[model samples]
Target: MTINLTLRQLELFTATMREGSFTQAAEKLRISQPALSTAIRKIEVELGLTLFDRTTRSVQPTPDGRHLFAVAEDLLRDFKVSMQGVAERASGLHGRLTLAVLPSVAASILPRALMQLQRKYPGIDVAIRDVMHERAVAMVADGLADFAVTTRIAETAALAYDEIGADRIHLVCRDDHVLAKGKGALPWSALEGHAYVAMAGSTSVRRLADAVLLQADFALQPRFEVEQIASCIALVSAGLGVTALPALTFSMFASDRLTMRPLTGPTISRQIGFLQLKGRQLSAPAVALAGEIRGAYGKR
Candidate 1:
C-alpha cells in the first residue's frame, strides 16, 4: 500500500525516538503532549504496525519501528541535503538567465562578455538567443528574456534600458573599395551618386543611414537591401556595396574581407545598451552577465 507521511509526523516521531519520551518531543515541537501522541498514532496507523513497546515506565521501539526509524533517519538526512541544495542554487547564483541579443551583437560582443562572466560567476547559467533587433527588444518586454543587449532600444511599456556603451558608425567596404584603401574619415558627398547596400527596412540602422544621407542632400542609393546585419556585412565582404555599421562590430570580426572607415558627415554614432522589462529586477546570473558586458569596454 502506498503511504503519504506528513513532515510533522516524521519530525514528531523522530524527536520522540531521540528524546525517549512523547513529553520531551511535545516540548521540542511546542505542542501539547496529547497532540504529539496523536501524531505518532496516525503515523503508526498509516504504516499498519506497532511502533513502540510502551507501558507506564518507559517507551521503546519494536523491531519494525527500529527498522522504520533507521529508514526515516536516512530519509530525513537526504531531505535536509536536498533543501540545502535548493537553497544553495537559489540563494547562491546557480540558475539560468535567459538572454536575448541582436544577431550582430551576439556574434562577437556577447561571446566575449560571457567568457568574462563565466570566470567570475561560474555557477550562473546563460541561455542566449540571437534574434533580430525588433524581436530581441520584444522578447525582453514579454518576459521571454531576462535581459537583452542591442544597438536599437525600443521604448515600450515592456522595457527599461540602460546605456552600456556606444560606437561610432563607420563606412564599411570591401578592402578593395576605394574608400577602404584610403581614409581618415569619409564625407557623405564622396558617395553622392554611388550605389549602396542597406538594411532591408524599418530597422533603426537603416533609418539612421537614411537620415544621415538625407541631411547631406543625397537620397539613398540602394543597389541591394537585406534584413540581417551579418548579411549586410557579408554583402560588403563580397564587394557588393558599401554600408555604414558600428565600428566595433567590423573591427572584432571580419578579417581583411572588409575595412571600416569613420563616417565623417556629421555625428555618426549609435549607443549600445541592455534592456529589460520595466521594474524587473535582474537575477544573479543576469546581473553577473551585465557586469561582464560593462567590463568589456573597460572604463566606458
Candidate 2:
C-alpha cells in the first residue's frame, strides 16, 4: 500500500531510530513513550514497512529505513530553516505600509509625519495616497491601505477611528482680497457678499461648511467649487475665490499671497483621526506603524 505518513510521523520514526527506543524518542519530543509508539506504528502501517527491527533488548533500523533516514533528515532541516525565516521576518521591523490620507493633508501635514516615521522605521516602504474620506475608509476596508487618516467618518460599519488631533477650520483668502483685512472674530454675516471657493457640493467637509453657513442664515457664496482641497487652495492662491479649511491646510501654503483668519460666531471643524477596518486585526508591521501614528498625534 502507498504510504500517507505525514512529515510528523516520519520525524517520529527518525527520532526513534536515532534514540534506538520509543522512550528516548518520547523524551526528545516531550511526549509520552506510548504516544511515540502509536505514531511509529501508524507510520509503519501506512508505509507497509517494518522500519524498526523490534527486539527485547533494543530497536534498530532496517536496510530501507536507513535510506529513508537520509531524506527525512533533509526534510526536517529544510522545514526548520523555512520556519526560521518566517519568524525572522515577522519579528523584524521591516516591510511596506500603505497609508491613505485626505488630499489636503497629503499637501500639508503628512509630509512632516512621514519624515518622522522614516527616522524611526527606516526600512519600511511607505506608500501614501491622496484620497477622499469615503475612499480612504474604503481603501482600508478593501485591503488597499493599512491605515487611513481622515477628518471625519460618515459611516461606522466598515471603519473605526481614534482621534489623533483636533484640526480647526480657518477662513482663507488672498492677501489682496477685501476680507483678508478683517481681524479678530470675523462675523458669520461677513461671508455673505464675498466670492468663495468651496469643495465640491458632494463632500462631507463641504456639507459641514454649508451647515455652518446655513446656521448663520447665509447661502454659500461660490465663485467655483472644486473636488479637491489642494485645488481649492490653488484657486484661493490665484485670487479666484476664498475657502475655509482645517488649520493644517495652511501648512501647505508656501505662497505669500494667501492667508487665513479663524472663523468665528460659529466654529466649523472636524477632528483628525486614524481609521482601520472595524473588526480586522492589524498585521504586526501595521500595528507598529499605527503606534507611531498614535504617538505622533498623541504627543501633539
Candidate 3:
C-alpha cells in the first residue's frame, strides 16, 4: 500500500522522538499535547505498526519508529537545501546565461560589460558564442541561445531587435598604405584602383561594404576574399590589400600595423543591438547582463 504523509506529520514525529516526551515535543512545536498525541496515533494507524512503548514515566521508540525517524530527518534536511537553491535562482543570485554575439561586439564592448555583470552577480555563469552577425541571429531564433548582440540583417517574426548603437564603417589598411597617409576622412573615390581585400560575401560587413561601393558607383573588384576578421586584418597588416570594416571590429587589429580612416562621401554605418525571441521573458541573469551591455554602449 502507498504511504500518505505530510511534512508536518514528519516534523512532529521527529520532534517527539528527539524530546522523548509528547508533552515536551508539543511545547517545542507550539501545539497542545493531546493534539500531538492524536496526530502520532493517526501516523501509527496508517503505518499499521506500533511506533512507541509508552509508560507513566517515559516514552521510547520501537524499531519501526527508529527507522522512520532517520528517513524523515534526512528528507526534511534535503527539502530545506532544495528550497534555498530555488530561491537563489529566482533572485538571479545563482544561474546560467548563454549569449550569441558578433565577434566585433564580443571583442570591443562585451568584455567590459561582462566584468560589470560578474561584479554584481558573481554566482551567475555565462557562455558566449562569438560568431558572425547571421549566425548570431540564427542562434537566438532557433533557441540555441538566450539572446544575441548583433546587427539587424532582416526582419523575422521569431525575433525582436533592440537597437543600442551604430558602428561607422572605416577603411582599414597598413600604416604604409597610401590611403593611410591622409589625415582626415577619406572619400570613396580614393579606393578606385586599389586592390580590395573583401570579407566573405555572406558576412554583414561584406554586405554593407558592397552597398557602399555600389552607391559610390565604384567598380573595383576584390583581390582576396577571407571568411574571418583575423584573416582580413592579417592580409591588410601584411600590405596585401585594403578592406572596409565597422569601427567596433577595429578592436581586433593591432594599431601599430593597421590604420582605420572613416569612410565619407556618404558615410556608412550598421545598427548594433540585442536580438531575443518575441514575447519571451528573459531570465533574471540575462536581464542583468543586458543592462550591463546597455551601460557599456551608452558611454559610446
Query: In lDDT terms, which candidate is top?
Result: 3
- Order of the predicted models by lDDT, top scorer first: 3, 1, 2
> Which ranges of candidate 1 are over 4 A from the true structure?
1-80, 152-155, 251-253, 297-300
All-Cα superposition RMSD per candidate: 5.7, 6.3, 3.7
Please give the distance, in angstroms, between residue 211's alpha carbon in candidate 2 and its true position after superposition. 1.5
Candidate-wise lDDT, in order: 0.78, 0.77, 0.90
- What's the true lDDT of residue 256 in model 3? 87
Clashes of each: 0, 0, 0
* Candidate 2: regions farther than 4 A off: 1-88, 298-300
State every prediction's TM-score relative to the real structure. Answer: 0.70, 0.67, 0.77
lDDT of 1 by residue, 58-171 (tens): 889899888888888888889998888787576535778889876666765777788877776677888889876788887887789999888756566767888877778778
Q: Worst ten-residue run, lDDT, model 2?
A: 291-300
Q: Cα deviation in Å at residue 126, candidate 2?
A: 2.0
Clashing pairs in 2: none
